[model samples]
Target chain A: MKTRYTYGGDEHIYVEIDDEMSLDAFFIALSLSNMVREANIPGVTEILPANASFEVRFDPDVIAPDAMMEKIKAFEHQAEAQEKRLDTRIIEIPVYYEDPWTHETLMRFRERHQDPTGSDLDYAARINGYETVADFIEAHHSQPWFVSMVGFVSGLPFLYQLVERDKQLEVPKYLRPRTDTPKLTVGYGGCFSCIYSVRGAGGYQMFGITPMPIYDPEQKISYLKDFMAFFKPGDIVKWKPIDRAEYDRITQAVEDGTYTPRIAEVAFDLDAFNDDMTGFNAKLMEALNDA
Target chain B: MTLEIIKPGLATTIQDLGRPGYFHLGIPEGGAMDRLAFRAANLLVGNDEGAAGLEAVFMGPEIKFGAEMSVAVTGAEMPMFLDGEPRETWTSFTVKPGQVLSFGFLKTGARIYIAISGGIDTPPALGSRSTYPIGALGGFEGRAIAAGDVIPVGDGSVVAEGRVVPDALRRRPGSPAELRVLTGLYWHRLTEKSQKAFFEDDWVVAPEADRMGYRFRGGQPMEFVDRPQPFGAGSDPSNIVDGCYSYGSIQVPGGLEPIVLHRDAVSGGGYFTLGAVISADMDLIGQLQPNTPVKFKRVEMDEALAARAERKTMISEIRQSLS
Candidate 1:
């Protein structure tokens, strides 16, 4: 695959792996960015991996831009040639669907929504050919999703389903952005899904609320103590539907600092998955369930 | 030493060069908007270029000195006063114990920077005193200063007083400022007519502008080349597959308003960015007030690099002249 590299002013170099978002493009970006980080280049200030592209911010004073670009190209070559496996963790996120908080918040901003009469979940389900919201939620949780990027806000993961393009759920963003979205609100837009890490302006269609926090600045949660953000690019996430009672219990545990996210170490083989998704996913889920 | 905020002006906060190297974690490089003015104030106070200082917006703070200190005011041209008596700007001055420092109406520019001999003594978070208010991270308990709040001052050694930055070095924020930009990334996504309009139109900064981004109006609604929207790309014509955003990149969402992403902006989004404001012109953007008219001028890579080098040389000259 060809990659396009462009200069973002004198300080940043943006590398676009592909024009479209695909698991293959994301893998290339993830591998390339990881290699750049491991190289520990002195002048490189930041390595931001996105859906199908990555950006590197460097100080030209410390290392010439040309030299830095050359180094990145070299890293890209090495990354592409390396093994197709990636060392990452699969996390299970418990969510309360059609929660009251997001329900109220979404209703208040109905004018901004495409279908103001119905809830976000109802609109999403109907457009995607599902007869009921429950069936839509079941389809969403049946398969795992890959964390293609972690951005837009701190710890907010943009997840793309592991299924083929035909099976992927697609929805349009709000006609206009809402002034406020409740924190941890599980939102779906375009063909990707995300959990709002903070309460701020958002245009995604809110469907539910996650009980656990993906971002903890104080690092109160043991799993997030090392870093304020929980999700990283390439991490797999499995959403689990939960009742209000379980949601309240998990919320209380989170507040008491005893909630540890269900995470299992796994080596993802991109080639194997691309070749045979069902066989690959069965193995991937087994790794998580067995662990 | 400490300084008590007798009257907290509009959005006063502690800032420095900002936290870098953490954009991967989705943290913005929050810092003083006007880098040139920030460094000027620090240099005037004999502190390092990255020393923490106070950034006041629109109105300046009324601070009462708890101890004797040397200070300098830079950026926006605001009327300065010491205990109800007039004071000077762009030059260093001494403040006696119990003296109250204040300012009058803003004459020009948007932000005013206050630098003391000893910098603001807020403990650094994530390697800088710069405040990221969205995450409530870094600088003076991670929030804007309020009245009755007392902030600590570092034991910074003072240089001779009355050191002034030459008038030529000072940036004059004017109406319809021409900002140089290097068009790239998704620049080709826009149609020829829209691209021409972007450069030809005189854009007015909206009043809702803040540290995150500056929205502009008056340009013909930008039009994109027709194409099938890719998966995960939104329905908007300006939307693309999610991509990384440079600090100064310009994005036209919904093709209506063009927003210039700033130091405190999100790291990446699905919006299609036309280009970025060159590093040298970022300081100029920092001084842009609401309703300010601006124009974008396209430049080559060589010109951008040369301008960046010129800024570096200018900073070094200012430091040498002060020392």
Candidate 2:
């Protein structure tokens, strides 16, 4: 795929690896971003890695835009030639599907949704060929998702399904963005799903709410003591659908600083995955189970 | 030392040179909008150029100094009052204990930077003392300073009053500010007519102006080049697959008004950005008043870089003059 490099003023350079978002496209973009970070190119102040794209904010005074572009091209080539295995973590996040909080939120913003007559879950379920919301929920948590990008807001992780492209769930964002989304709400838009790290403006359709806090600036939660943001790029997430009782229990545990997300170390090999998607996925699951 | 907030003006927040290197985490480099004014205030008060200071919008806050300390105010032409007596802005003055420094209605510009001899000693969040309320991090209690809030101040024992920023050094937007724009990013998405109209038209700053972005209206509704929507991009003609948003990136959602993302905006979104205001000209956006007319002047990369250098040189000149 041809890459597009465009300037964002004098300070930033946006690099689009592909117009379409896919795991394969994202892997290459991540690889290049990783290489650029490792190089520690002077004047490169901030390197943001998005799905199928990346941006670098730099000091033009120190490193000219042309020079930065040349180095990025070299790094991209080098990264493409390197092995495609990435050391990552698989974390289990407990989600309460069709939770009351998000339901109320989505209901409040129905005027902005594609189907004002139905709930976000119902609309998403109908569009994706699910007989009922329950079936759609099953399809959502049936497989793990890859954390392709973490942004738009503090600690928000955009998840792309681990399954093949044909099996991916596609949903359009709201006709207009909602001014308020419940924090930790599980939101789906386009081919990706996201957990709202903070309560703020969002366009994604609300599906559920997770008790697990992805971001804690206060570090009140013990597990998040290391960093404010929990999810990182390249991390894999396994969703565990829980009832209200379990959600409450986890929420209590989270407040008590006793709850810790179940995380497992895993190494992803793109070559193996491309060769046999089913076989590699089973192995990846095995790795998570082993941990 | 300590300072008590007697009155929290409209959208008063603590800011510095901003925290960088965390855009990947979606935290913006949120600091002073007018970097030169911020630096001038700090330099006037013998504090570090990047020291945390109060950035007040149209209205200014009433801060009561606990003890005699040197302070300076810069940016925005406003009437300053020291315990009901008129005081000059852009010139450092000594405020005694129980003497509350305040301001009247702003005549021109939008934001003003108030630098205390000792900078506001707010705890740094992700390496910045800038108050970014959305993330609920930084500044006093990770939010805007409220009235009666007691804020900690660093050692400002080194005090030399009456250091003034010359009138010419004060940067204020003209009646119709000519903001330079570097057309790139998703500029190709806009029709040629729309592109030309964007440059030729005069836009007014909407009331939606804030630290997040400056929304411009009054321009002809932009028309996008029609094409089948991309796989993941939203249905809107102005929508693209969510991409990283740069500081000063101008996005026109649904081919309507352009909103230039500022220092405190989200790092990425799905809106189609036509281009970005050159970094050198971004500071001007902060001082823009509501209903102020502005024209987007297109500039090439070389010209943008030259403008950046010129801004840097001017800052250096200020530093040298102050020193």
Candidate 3:
């Protein structure tokens, strides 16, 4: 994998580890970006790692761009020699599939969608070769997903499914972006899934909504007391499809400040994961359920 | 002290140097659009350069002061009125206990920064007083200042009158503003003709300009080189795999209007960015009025760094002169 280092103006250095999306690409970016961060390099203000690329915002006044680029290059070399094990967290996200909130939002923005005749879930299911929406929902939560990137808005996680490439669910975004996307709306675009953390403009194909607070500035929820944004890069998420009753119960728990997201910590090795995807995912789920 | 809002002008919000170090969380380093103007206004009023101030766009809000304090207006060349009496902008003057301050229609620029003797005392979210309305994160109640809102202010002890920012030092948009851009990031995606036309064409600022970004139109439609879309890259030729977006990054959606992502920009998106406006030129973009003619000047890395240095020197000059 050739990492292309591109300069963004004077302060930002964008390093694209790969052109396309894959676990391999994300691992390289995450590992190298981590190395760069741990180096405690002066002038490196922000290190933002994405799905396949990473951005380093630096103060050129303190560290010259060419010199900073050299440091990053050296860090990349060190990252190659280092072990690719990431101590990450696996969290259970309860998704209310085909929820009424997203249903109403998708209908309202139907004219901006590729298929105005049916719901976003229907179009995505039909296009992905699923006979029924039930089968599509099963395929969605059948395996875990990686929080490859966290952005677009505060605390929003762009999730990439951990299933084999052939089984990956791919869907196109809306033809035109909707002016409003319900907060915590489960959305799909391209090959990634995302939960809208805030109610704002979005073009992703709506599938469902989550009752749990995706972002709370007040840190109202117990699990999120330490940080306002719950999901971070390197997080593993297992989507659990729930009914309306379970959604209401969880929503109430959230209001009472007693809700804690189901999470388990684990050390992930990309090489080990590549060898036996299903077997490793089962073990990860076991740990999560046990927790 | 408090400033009681009477007539909240267009999109007025509290802003400071902004909360940095939060871009990774998808939260932008949002602050005043015109940072130099905001800083100078604060300095003129004996406040810290990064103090929280009101960023009024296009128009100005009518505010009644609870106590006597010094005030200064900077950025756009708009006529200021203190209780229906004309007052000089860019000059620090004291307001009486109940004197109302207002502004007339803008003459040249889009935004005006108002700095009081003491900074706005709005509670910060994530270490910034800057308003990010999309996230409802900061500023007065996480939104724009409205009528009947009595926003608190820090205590002002020193009242220095006759402090003025000279016209030569103030930032003013030239006739047909020229913005220096270091074009690189996905410039190769566009056809050779499109690349050449991007610099040659004269563009106009679209009405869609805001704190998030400035959209420019009137340029010829861009054409992309023929290439099969990559995996996870949306169907559009303008689409790339979702990636990080930096401040001042310019992304042309649908090969139509070019939007320059600003301080409050979404950190990552799927669209391809042509390049970024140099950091030095970013402050000037915030002052551009809609329909204002503009030219994009292509610059290299060496020149971009030189401009950055030059701007730093200019700021230092402003600081020294004010002190």
Question: Per lDDT, what order, best first?
Answer: 3, 2, 1
Model 3 misplaced stretches (Cα beyond 4 Å)? A108-111
Please list the Cα RMSD from the true structure of every candidate, rounded to 1 decimal place. Answer: 2.1, 1.9, 1.9
What level of docking quality does candidate 2 show? medium
Tens digits of per-residue lDDT, candidate 2, B82-155, equal 99999898898998889999899999999999999889997888888999888888988888889999988998
Estimate the TM-score for candidate 2: 0.96
lDDT of 3 by residue, B1-323 (tens): 99999999989999999999989889999999888898899988999999999999999999999988999999998999999999998888999889999888889888899999889998989998899888788899889999999999999765678888877788877869999898877888999999999999999999888988899999999999999877776677887778899999998877878989999888887778888999999999989999999999999988999989888887777788788
Task: Write model 3 residue lDDT over A173-263, tens digit each, in one string.
Answer: 7765677999999999888899999998787899898898878776657877788898888899999999999999999998988788888
Best by DockQ: 2
TM-score of each: 0.95, 0.96, 0.95
Weakest 10 consecutive residues of candidate 2 chain B by summed lDDT = B230-239
Candidate 1 local lDDT, B1-323, one digit each (tens): 99999998999889999988777767888899999899999999889888999999899999999888889999989999999988788899888899999999999898999999889998898899988877778877778898999999999765677899988788765668888899988998999999999999989988868888888888898888998887678677777777889999998877778888888888877778888998888888778888899999999878888989898888887888788
Candidate 3 chain B least-lDDT 10 residues = B157-166
